[model samples]
Target: MGIDACTSRPFRGSEAVARGEVSWGRLAGPAFRPLLTDVYVGSSAEVDTATWVRAVALWGRGAGVVAGPLAARAWEAECPWEERELIMPTSRRETSDEIDVRRDRLLPDEVCFRYGVAVTSPARTAFDLARRGPLVEAVAAVDAVAFRCGLTSAHLLAVAAAHPGARGSVQVRRVVALMDPRAESLMETRLRLVFILRGVPAPVPQYEVRVRDGGLRWLDLAWPRVPAGRRKLGLEYDGPEHRTITGQNRDLLRDADLDDQEWEILHIGAVQVFDERRADQLAARVMRRLNPDP
Candidate 1:
């Protein structure tokens, strides 16, 4: 059979073979790729996070609720694709390198269906994600979910309160305190956490200032504390979008305009923001700018 005869959506390999949709021999061929044990998708199917989440749901016979990072992505949060996770009420011996199965009971309020896939509610997803990662990563995850789902600190706190005895409740609360829906990108959140983690006061996110032309410009992060003969400090995280010639030229103009308005803008790239040593150095530089010697 040709590849076109295979099911476009994910299907059980055994079922497909039994139904004569595709022979066992064909499934073993390159036309189909296994997502989970016995769960197969046509090789040409676009397999993104959503596809994997759906596959896991199918593998469980629709008995599991998608949770953790996968749940966060399903909610449109800016989360990096990580291991597929599922929460089941009972223990199962099935094991797969690709999926992390958590055997736990979820409260009724904690589960919801999205696009026909059962997933943890936004609050629960944020609560779960924030509980057990590096503090910076936890904050970023919560910020993304909060920003995308319009979740407030109260919503996160409520979930924390509900799960008081949960493993990472303390960390979850800490993440809630740092959560800011104003964060526009993951790197921006990580950059902000770098400073705050180093005992720097949290800078205002998406800070707005009026330029010489009477138009407003927003800084990714800013400290409006003005010292004598010194301009306010502004920080920006430059991602791949800023590497193009046009983007670089536009940044130069923007920086010049902001400079004219007594704002000292510092642009940081992935290397400076992601590398541990470099991030520490960048934070130190900002501290000096924020507190100049007499």
Candidate 2:
């Protein structure tokens, strides 16, 4: 009867019409916003994680199981939100604008229920995304799920080992090998990968540094095993969050304190990550620091 039932949650248009709570004509009007083909949310409601999960329920129609990035999102793993991805073992069919449907089967233990919708387990979701494409993002996706789900590299390797001939299995192995639980952001993972792929010594993530004022600070990327008397190097990705005055002031203080403790800190932003030249220069700078001339 009220928008609360529909907008506050994901509801099928047909469900409301069949219950006589609303006329078919009313369901198609401005009062409701379409989430998928037959799914609608309250027009006034803000679409968020819960809404996305509910939309998955309506779109799935009890047949498909949520997979890929949507499953990762449901598990609270960090990833970009583009569209809802679903997989049904029933048949191979064309995908609709509402969601992506793949004709793939999951093992009995690979599916679980979350947000009132059937979804791939965290490990399964990580494996699925790792096999899906662009290696760097896939690696970041797996790292995120592992970090949040308390999964280890062994778990990811075990999952990869189970699917011998699966597509991207090799990439999955590579991603597992590079997975780091301490990585807290996609940019950090990407930057780390850049160093590895560039044949530079990989830095420790979330390394602890003792500040001059007795406070503890964590470095995003650090060469902590440098010689006892030699200074250590660190690289930090400064995203949009660091652009504000408060953030900048905090960073300045943190940098000064770390500098006093023999840390050679380098700061980069989103632009450096996207530009190949900038990324290469950063890698070279790190390498030079790691293996400085006599």
Candidate 3:
């Protein structure tokens, strides 16, 4: 297409050539980048999650419904993967290394439109993830979308119940059972999973502790019902926000107040989340603190 015709929007590579707005050779040039196979995005266009989702629709046509991370992203949920996922009914099959296609059946209601592109509903996205993803990741994904979409474990469970005999249904149920809507961050969800997987009793999320001055402090994870009476334990994931001087000073005084309240606080960072062994060790330490005699 002519530079003027590009208009900072995604268009089909064939459409550009057919309309004579641009040559086939120019279509392959740096002025445009491929968002999906045969789908090109103008270099000047803003390519974001919405653009990517809409671009896939151009290639998919009637082949499938956008599912998985793409669907989750369309629902405005934070999905970790960069690749797009589509679900084609068993009747249709398409091939692409760039896109992950799931051949499965979807109820009419499970499919809906977001940003003008057909995608899995929030409930279905969580269901698909729990059914197909690894246990921990499935839980995290479910937590993220559920939190973003204002869904609850009941919503995910209802979707799971609708798809009986589906692959990983048992595992999906287990994940839904453990998912908590109060988790506001991926790291917080992951940290909760670590504690659960290690056989430690789950801590209350966003737990509030009253300070001496009457102001309340909320903790990321807190356990007040430990085995040995009222020994309160709090766990915090120090994300980038904690790196600033203001954040540090506030945390110093907050921790001091928690200390005064006889609370044992444990802090972990992003680096600990990626190390499975270390994460488990940290959870083990917390478990020891929660149950000093056990």
Best by lDDT: 1
What is the C-alpha lDDT profile of model 1 across 1-294, one tens digit per residue?
A: 433434556778887777777788888888888888889998888887678778889887788899999899899888754868889878874576867888866889999988678999999998888886788888888889988999999998888777668898888778877889899778889889888888787899999989999988899999999666778999988888899999899899999999998889999888887898998998888887778676
Deviation in angstroms for 87 in model 2? 1.4
Q: How accurate is candidate 3 locally (lDDT)?
A: 0.82
- By lDDT rank, best first, the candidates go 1, 3, 2
Q: In candidate 3, list every pair of residues with a backbone clash.
A: 1-21, 1-22
lDDT of each: 0.84, 0.81, 0.82
Which regions of candidate 1 are displaced past 4 Å?
1-6
lDDT of 3 by residue, 127-146 (tens): 98777666777788888898
Q: List pairs with backbone clashes in candidate 1.
A: none
Q: Per-residue error at 69 for model 2, in Å? A: 0.7
Pairwise TM-score winner, candidates 1 and 2: 2
Best by TM-score: 2
Compared with the true structure, model 2 gives a TM-score of 0.94
Ordered from best to worst TM-score, the candidate numbers read 2, 1, 3
Off by over 4 Å in 3: 1-6, 227-231, 292-294
